[model samples]
Target: MRRWTPFVLLMPFQFIFGLIYSWGTISPAIHVQSGWPQATLDLAFSLTPLGLLPAVILAGRALHRLAPKTLLAWALTCFTVGGGIGLLTASPVAFMLGYSLLALGVGAGLSTAACIALVSRLYPQRRGSLGGALLALYGMSSVISAPLFDEINRLIGWRPSLAALLAVYAAVGWLAWAFLPEAPAAPGRQTAPLPLMVLLRQRPLRWALVIVLMATPLGSASFATIGHLTKAIGVSSALGVLAVSLMALGNGVGRLGFGLLADWISPRFSRAAALGLNALAALLLLGVLHGYGVWAFVAYPLLIGLAFGGMAGKLPALAAHVAEHHGEAAFGLLFGAFAFASFLGPFLSAGLGMHSALQGLALCALAAMGLGLAVAR
Candidate 1:
């Protein structure tokens, strides 16, 4: 039981950090209530990734010297302050700043790269399984937070509901920080940290980046646009929230399931399989665009969630596999590059329009499948 304490403690932070995924549900609500233009609302979500990119790059580099607890403290502070600002301010610029700050906090502290690096160091022998479990909670975060936020919004209002969320995040983040054990020192001859330029120059790392660039949009599109897509399909607002919840559920399962699969088989096979799922999800979305029934709504998000979760679960492992020599420091830079691509997915999707976005996702998956196969060679 004591041995399990670290992982158990890590779960809530992962869950809270995952509220980023709940943006699909939250964005639509804000738009409906505030009458903000779609572009402005979309920008709020986009700023998260934009903020995350630099913070993650820095956190990845800094983790070698700083403890996870230190970084997590920073993350908690940013998240709380950002949310507090959002709670107080109604101005679009102010809200964007608040959301961007939250994203920066997420990138700097609670990122998947940080979580994977910390846990893998603690449980070196079980890196794949442990990484997956932690990330699964992260993926599942949306499932729990989205519905809870929706209910809170229904009861009070979006602003107060957001405040309630920040309060919970603060409490949980503190507990996780207090309980998290120090990351064990690297066991073998530690290689010097690779420069970002050198890491990017490697052939396999470049391929991994390509795979991320292609696959991330498929998942992010569903995350950012699902509520609108559900309504477009003539579903009720209540059902739209349900679709977001279901996507998150699928996201959690995919993270756990694919993480374990990568451990059991190989990261390469797991990635290929995930991309295949993404391809199928893209097709499903196409069907929906062509006037498929409610079932298309149901099936589309589940598959995309799985693909997204699996991709998120596997990519870190794949980067580690490709750059094993550089160790955790390198993992941060590699994963940070992938995060940049992940950001582009939703940002572009909002601008491109839904049907075109889905079509673009299909093409990306197909392209990634070829890239995955080539990398395997």
Candidate 2:
């Protein structure tokens, strides 16, 4: 394979996100149009992560044995079908199922299995930077998706916008599968399949896992909080929408910026600082939640956005390190476990509610900080 082949493969990956997850930015608008309460939309959004749990674990195992490109292509097809189903129908159950399908495809194909394979095999020297750039690209989807979807929904409604996304996911997946080369399997350098429990037993490994788990609530709190701030702070819906784009910008910046830091500094240091910043950001939210207009409107998203965004690039690098320290075979399982935590964070944060979630997430951040310190030491 040419050296630049993997980089080219990233295009479809970015496009899938632009269509699928980016659609999330317009979720608020969808809520209004469907006559469904925010809770219903939350329920639908929640399905993605929830559905990811088994999907990620299973995908990891399958990729260990099968060709990743083939699997990715099939998963992308599933994503298209799932997304298509949800877009065409307004049934709450159907919508949730569609999201679950998309989640399954993404979890199995994009987020865990294919991503790990791509970075670990192709860009060994530039792990942090490459991973961060990839994640940052994913974050950019929100910026592109939010206003684009908002405009699309205005013109044709949510259903058509979703259907358009479904088409994109399908096309991108097919192109990637057709062209992306499979890395040749190695001999002798074998990994033993360790159970999740055994992998979690190592202290450093546990801390690394905890970092992702801890990050989940932090990221989720931010996602749910957008609407809350609009209501509580009395910001114009326009400003609230703008905040979402800013958050996406912060997310991309964090991924690329912190990722570069991870390469220059130690992953341990980069992760610890990120978690501490997360704690501080959550604290900032708590302090400013009651403040008027600008502070209430601007402060939380800016900080939370940075903290959550920074984690994407760093976490995978951290995971790879932890896996290297543990064993290579353990990488898939450990990452799967981490994905489980990622899935849990949003719902847990949502359950924490507007005001209280910040405090709970702050504690999680502090705990992550502690774990990070232990890992560093």
User: Against the true structure, whose lDDT is highest?
Assistant: 1
Per-candidate local distance difference test: 0.73, 0.64
Write candidate 1's Cα lDDT for 192-247 as tens digits. Answer: 45677887788776777777877777787777678777877887788887777677
Error of 2 at 371 (Å): 3.1
User: For model 2, how does the per-residue alpha-carbon lDDT over 1-377 read when each residue is reduced to its tens digit?
Assistant: 48878767865675564344564655666777778777877677666655655565666555555555665665676676777676667687787787554634353434445665566567766767776787777667655656666777788887787677557657766777677777655222255345567766767777666667776466656765676667766777887887776776777788777777777886776777678777777667656564633565466676667777777667556666666633333445544554565556656656666666666766777777777766684
Superposition error at 156 for model 2 (Å): 3.0
Clashing pairs in 1: none
Task: For each candidate in turn, give its C-alpha RMSD to the true structure in angstroms.
Answer: 3.1, 3.3
| TM-score against truth, every candidate | 0.87, 0.85
